[model samples]
Target: MDVKYQVFISSTYNDLKEERQEVIKVVLQMGHIPVSMEFFSAADEDQWSLIKGLLDECDYYVVIIGGIYGSIEEKSGKSYTQLEYEYAVEKGIPVIGILNRDVNRLSAEKRERKKVNQEKLAGFSELVKRKMCQFWSTPSDLASNVATSLHKLMNKNPRLGWTRVLPKEHPIEEIVQTVNVDIPKPKNVVSNGILTERDIRKVLKKGLFDFGSFIDIYFIIEGLYSHSNTETKLPNSQLEWIRKNEIPAHLQQVKEIWTRSYRCIYTFINIRDLAQKRGVPQDVISIGNIFISYIYYVLTEVWGDVPYFNNKPELEMAPKGSSNVKEIRTLSLANLQSVLHDSTLSTQHVDLAVGVAVRWELQAKNYSKAKEYIDKLINRDRYKLAPVHEIFSTDVESIGYFDTDQEGSQFHNPVFRVLCKKGRFVHYLRYTEVLLMATEIYFHLSDHQKALYYINLVRIRNNQPQLKETGNNFIATLLDDWKANLGMEGSYFSALKRNGYAEKVLGIPAFKSVLPIPAQEIALNPNMQQNEGY
Candidate 1:
């Protein structure tokens, strides 16, 4: 399988543009994705969220601590370079630091001008040395060190990433074509209404999906849950979706309100039963939980009520009389626990399974269990609590993508492009949320000290001082941190949707927290009804 990793590059952009380009080249050559601030704007609050998210998704973090102190965030008075390092270490990501050998011999333009920034830069470089790091005087030398360092750390860390689904396949090709596209709105989405694909057949899309089909389930799941949409619905357009103090009503596709939705959920009971009967490997059987876990969570995220404990393939109407997400979550936990017991899966795979359960606990406001699962998610040896940058020469695919094909511009997200093209497996979980969940769990539990302990780790990682107060203000900060780190990763959208903030943010009243059943479904089935507002 062709597996690629995303690396975040953090440093001053203008000065080290050449060095950044070289680094990006090496990462691409090695079949990894390089994410840098070049794809973002320092002034945009929305882009900062993406910056955090990219850092969160990356497998390895590399720090190029050159002479320059880099750009600073006004609120914190700390350079992003320093803050990036803080986040990478705080997150427990493997850190590989490369220094610009013999600092004094460097050209004056590349070095820091302000005395305070120079001092800060010196301290940051020293901090990188506290771990396994290297020194390089030139961009080429830096590339060599970076390649070797990342190579070693990958063998050591081995994150849950995509592999080739087919045997002896060529690397996934990046087709950069200039083509105009009008992103289509999802059809059949009514205001504040849930749109579920009628049955597992809707999920299979007129294809066969028996439990005994072990060899091809992963491909089927990946095809169904692609991050890219058939309709080209934008994912995390930082400019429009995540702005502060401003609701972006225009960017939203008027699908649910003016149109309708066509989506689906499958029964976990059948998948489990079939896998067991087929005598599939525990790993394969367990992966089914990931698919089902996602389906359960997405339904809960939109509707807060869904059918649970159903052995039947079709769930036409939601169960009546108190079938909240809590019950659905309990069933999910039981199913995932059996999957977690097997030793064949990777830690990332196991953590991925548990993280969804924690998300459910948070959604249900079950703080204690969220805290417990979070403890299991964070590993001192396996995860990191900081940010690292794999810098790029330009923002080509990372950001600043307003250019349309009419003007002959092409855009691509390296990660998504690769995963959809040649990658194997369906990985829906983001492990960084474990720490963020801990902070929220502790905050809700009124364990201020513990809450600050977790929140401060991320705060201090961003080169900001700890919060002086550990009250609602601290919790507010924690939520912002959560939104920033989680961004558009489905978690944030779901969180906002679950809490009825989507109506507020999207500037639509009928945009209810729960989606309404389609009018057609109501006609076909007498038991079906609509959401309250819709």
Candidate 2:
């Protein structure tokens, strides 16, 4: 049987220091624990008790009788080293005693300085010699000799030694404590609103561009290979900041994003409040509620958590566990459309509202709810797949502007036509995309029949043939549709993350599914912690 013996190394402190170290090295290499004077305290009563305790626990004793008689314990009238050796003898510990081969040949400084000390040294050497004494001229030789002797002693004595997994007096929890990381959430359920001129203009403005561009650049790096081949090498520090998914300090002229977003949300609420106080139109309150909801959606996507309750912006962050993006998106749409019924909300705005709702529901993984929003636009039959020419078309209409058939601008689609004047249909959503999303949802739901039906609906719209069902065909079709329609406008990367494909697509680890909080933000806010990987 194997055992790990604790072998006590006894020696004069000054002369045998090197030899003790060498013995410890050899003992450790042989899988035994070495105890020695190096770890002991003074020659007092308490230390004597400690030494006796150590001797009692040890499996064997080592007496290295060098040239010098070390300091004496006054009570015992013997060098402490000799006292320890004798105590081990009384305790019946297996002893391996080593002697200097040429003690007389050593220099005067290496030998005992006083006559009494010299006599004590000679007596101690004689006592150790009474056992099976070993002789060595050097530390190395003594280490090797004592190792062989200790092994024999251990086999002869046959006592149990130290081991792992021994029973303890207390549980493991007594010694160690664990701390958990804080995760953030989204908050504030304002009676949410639909798309409006004020909301659109605010989204389009410069103050919000930093926040929007933060998203664009982030997805650009994370989705680089999805569209471009430009290799990006950034310093770890800058990369860490980018990983926070916030605007980098160097990219901004001012850190006004938080204030701007806050002000925008607050201003809407204030306007709505003042209007109510003045007995203004009910549509005014609807506008405030819907914008508040939109702001909540934006903040949730950007910061992972934000607070807005009962149409109010709470300054603090929301708890991550409490967030339910699906419920928020679902409830907000109802309030938005209800407000619309009381006002003349345009078809384009209504489509945008539902498109946003579809997006949020998908993000929340509420497939059925997302499909509800998708079907609304699909039932309307107003949006369709952009023709091949329309998709590949230039941003500007052809020089012959009179040609109604000419290629058009990149912003005319029902979902994405907000910025386009008259050029063509550039959509954030189209009938084909809605069909693809339905296909994706059903595939996730394991309804292969419906998945196939919806996928073919998209295929026919794109003037392409229906896909043949096979392993991973749904994913292939979804990617194909993304390539043909939503080509590289920041949605592909998000979709990849949602489907657990970002690691395969972007070569990033799964723990980095979200960007780290900005390093500066973390530095400034002690309450915030970086996301796991970053």
TM-score of each: 0.43, 0.45
Write model 1 residue lDDT over 45-69, tens digit each, in one string. Answer: 5556556666676677887878888
Tell me the lDDT of model 1 at 474: 62
Residue 345 of model 2: what lDDT? 49
TM-score of 1: 0.43
State the lDDT of candidate 2 residue by residue for 480-519, as single tens digits. Answer: 5665555434456556656767577556566555543433
Q: Highest TM-score: give the candidate number.
A: 2
